[model samples]
Target: MGNLLGNWRFKEPSTVEECDSTWGSDSESDEPAAEDDSGISESVSPAESEWPPGNNGDLSPKLTDSPEFLPKMKRSFYAARDLYKYRHCYPNYKKSRQPNEYRNLRFYLNKIPLVPDGIYIEEILTRWRGDYDKLEHNHTYIQWLFPLREQGLNFYAHELTQDEIKEFQSTREAKRRFLAAYSLMLDFYGIKLLDKSGNVARSSKWQERFHHLNESQHNYLRITRILKSLGELGYEAFKAPLVRLFLEESLHRNTLPNMQHSILEYFVYTIRRPAARRHLLRYARQHYKPAHAFLWGPPPKRSKPKSGDVGASVGAGSSGIRAPAPTPEPQRRGGETSFIPASGCSGTLVSYHDATVCQDVDAESLNAYTPLGSSMDGPEGVFMMILERNNYSGAVPL
Candidate 1:
């Protein structure tokens, strides 16, 4: 192990006092390992205790343990440490000897060239819990493999080797296991993984219909079509910083949906709770910017043509915010009209008139869905009826 400790030098000094003073300082040992009560062997390899004790009774200030030493060492040399000493002598590697904070795992992992090379066991052992179960699950695969789908692997071909992909595939049995491993981090938050395998299957079965798209269109389809069509499943909304991180990281144009879903699952696994649906809706409205013509409801009624408001619809003010207009009278179909200001396109057609007289409102009169009339006490007043056929071929009345 010591030999395998590659060229990993302690970025900071390590000391006897630091190693000896702390029990379980060795990340590998929390409880007694296979070794009996002698604690770890006093064999004391150079890697374990090279630093001399100081005159101050503590180890020399220059020899204080590195902050990231344990993680770096654990990740790199753990498997072959005693098995093969030369494994630790890699080029360009630095050994951290101090107390490592969780946030520094990336800093260390970023330096390692091999996949599944090191396990941040100490960090995982301590912080790994139900509250952070999602993260743990996500890192399970990431611990042993890369976090990517087949398409993502293809997209980032240069980053991983074929052997690495094989290693990743071998680590998990089911799709969920693979998903859960990468999903744990995001699940910590309130994001749930939405399985759209059926949709994928359906699309596969009918591949010819979608084959006409060019590569860019295919890329877009790879993301938006399957992912978004799952409706709310594809989205992940969390607290501010995480949300911002996801939007910036996962929502880029080149990002494929499969990748988006994985990254989103990773983030969702991290979220503590699914934020209020309305909160998500608010973000959608602000970000999606759906156009008025694309909206399903009737076009906004013509306003009185207020000054400075130029072709502004009745619902929209100069500020461009769509204000809620008063309820519009129901469509009068065949029967006597009962004036009810319908809140939406569909409403209960309650009438004070007798049930027989309350047959369907006249279809012609239904077109006069006036938004303004006050009451329906007499014949002059409006009657309410839902339009059975939404196909109104005639021009929209102002």
Candidate 2:
């Protein structure tokens, strides 16, 4: 499964802003990136060139995500999964004047920025994006797709900027493609987002993908970055159900073992919506066992369950005929706690967790996780920065 890739061609729009530099407009590899670093500044303006091709003015979610269209899309993704290569990448690495400041911009617009691994944005979306093996085994792609402010395991992917975030948020075409990226990754994780139905649910591939998820490592961080980026990019409505499904498998069905900590600390805490966070916390409180009491504050005072009630019913079939002794409660981790990672840490972790759900996060605290000095225009300078700093690069696994 880790080596499987689907062969889906990038369907080009009728027009593009930057000379239509999209996959349809150019070869998988472009000219040798100019070796000079200083020339890669904002030589070209975004208004003139840095937008991805328009959807031909036809992005009415209704038609694109229709019942008729989705079946084809699903087939397209899974058709060659059984036969494609495990890993496909650029033939060689190249550096040019396309600065890191415009990395997300150029990639989203299908313009001139190649990721640190030298893979073009269009190529990843075409050959590797739908592949289960490439998505899982290829460690560098996630950083380019769901980029975070922090230092990821891969030093190759670019850091994000505030200006890039604001512009990307406002660009309609970028948002559409971002959602496409989100959908592909969700399919890999066994959850499917249904735009036509206006809902999200487990896909037919759920069981197998869920199994692979439990057996893997470092996905909690990936998930946290995804959840955080979704909210940052104006997709708040999508986080809850995805979180609920994972929690259900882990806390309810016991299918995803030893991941309760990662789900709560990393994935759940990264949620930006206040209402959704509270709802998920309440749901977790309902499903989590008494041993995990530290997670959602103290349990309501314990009393023996009376016969014929729901509590008594839950106890009767849970392992033995008789209810067992309750373990003493563990104290909750105080709010505003920073979970610095130690060597050989088991569950994936976030840098911080706010036990108090209603508290407001300051701007710096919001980005307290970043390791780089900041986003830069020159990849040459950033590559040197990556080498000079060990605090962030060594802190977490990709």
Candidate 3:
């Protein structure tokens, strides 16, 4: 079987010359295949390949061939950088940074630019003041003025004349808007309405207006706001007027409690002088009921029990016979006198009639006494102490 297979067949290997010829034909076909794989290789010239050639051996294309290419690249790079910088500046940039709607003319003014001119100011005032005859003209003026004012042109307020000021102040609407417009300017120019005596004329005007208004027609709330503003603006002249208002006989007591309270608050919290504070405390104690004494501060502290008294009380309690109740002290006419144990040996006794009077006395000296409770009597002692400490001796009449 082996002899038959050998005779039947395996061909001999090709010679080296034949092999070389065959490989040479295959290589010729492979050259075209390789060129097809890289289509741009044949299209690119040696001069183009040598482009941008330097000691650095940069392989990038020469942009100089196309004159517009470098400029366009530079522009694109700078534009991208600028865009990045702008985005970085406002990371959460949005169109709705400020509110569109305003609650009042004052708020609107704050949001707007300052446009200072007489015509523009009058036009704005007329619009807010609801002048129907000049409505159209005012509207047009406002539209133009709004943008300018938003740009911070405040010349309009300075351009106002005394007559214009008086006209504006004649109506509440115009007055409000005008005041809002010039509030900052008033501070800037140190503009104060003063008389020949250097007292604030506005305060006198307000006081006169207050007296003229009937109880039913009185705008206490508005008056209070104005007074508060004046006080905040360092107008000391108004304080006396406020005190007079508090004591006004024509004013309704029931209706004026809130106003009175506000006045007292100003006196108590705002006034720094010892005389002013003493006056306020005296007035409040004389006027305000004992129930309302908490407006000042906590009640006065009670005296602690003595060690000997505690032992005596305990011994009395241990006995079967109950201790007799102490006799009630005699009541004084018009008011009452009560004793309060204050400190060691000495106790404080207060008398209340039209006003309060306090005297420190030895507890052993009194014939009969009663411990003071949480009634109005406590504040009397506190007020008397305050008055005495401040050397205020003038008696307050009922």
Judging by lDDT against the true structure, name the best candidate.
Answer: 2
Off by over 4 Å in 3: 1-218, 247-258, 266-277, 289-294, 297-398
TM-score-wise, the better of 1 and 3 is 3
Sort order, TM-score high to low: 2, 3, 1
Instruction: List model 2 lDDT by residue over 2-72, tens digit each.
Output: 44423333232221121111112122233222111000011111111011122643111122322223211
Candidate 1 per-residue lDDT, tens place, 16-75, comes to 212111121222223322211000011111211111224644221122233322111111
Q: TM-score winner among the candidates?
A: 2
TM-scores across all candidates? Answer: 0.19, 0.51, 0.24
lDDT (Cα atoms) of all candidates against the true structure: 0.25, 0.45, 0.27
Distance from true location, Cα of 150 in model 3, Å: 20
Residue 191 in candidate 2, Cα distance off native in Å: 1.5
Per-residue lDDT tens digits for candidate 3, residues 79-151, read 1221122212212222233453322233233334333222435445444432322422221233222211111
Candidate 3 contains a number of clashing pairs equal to: 13
| Candidate 1 stretches greater than 4 Å from native | 1-158, 170-177, 194-287, 290-398
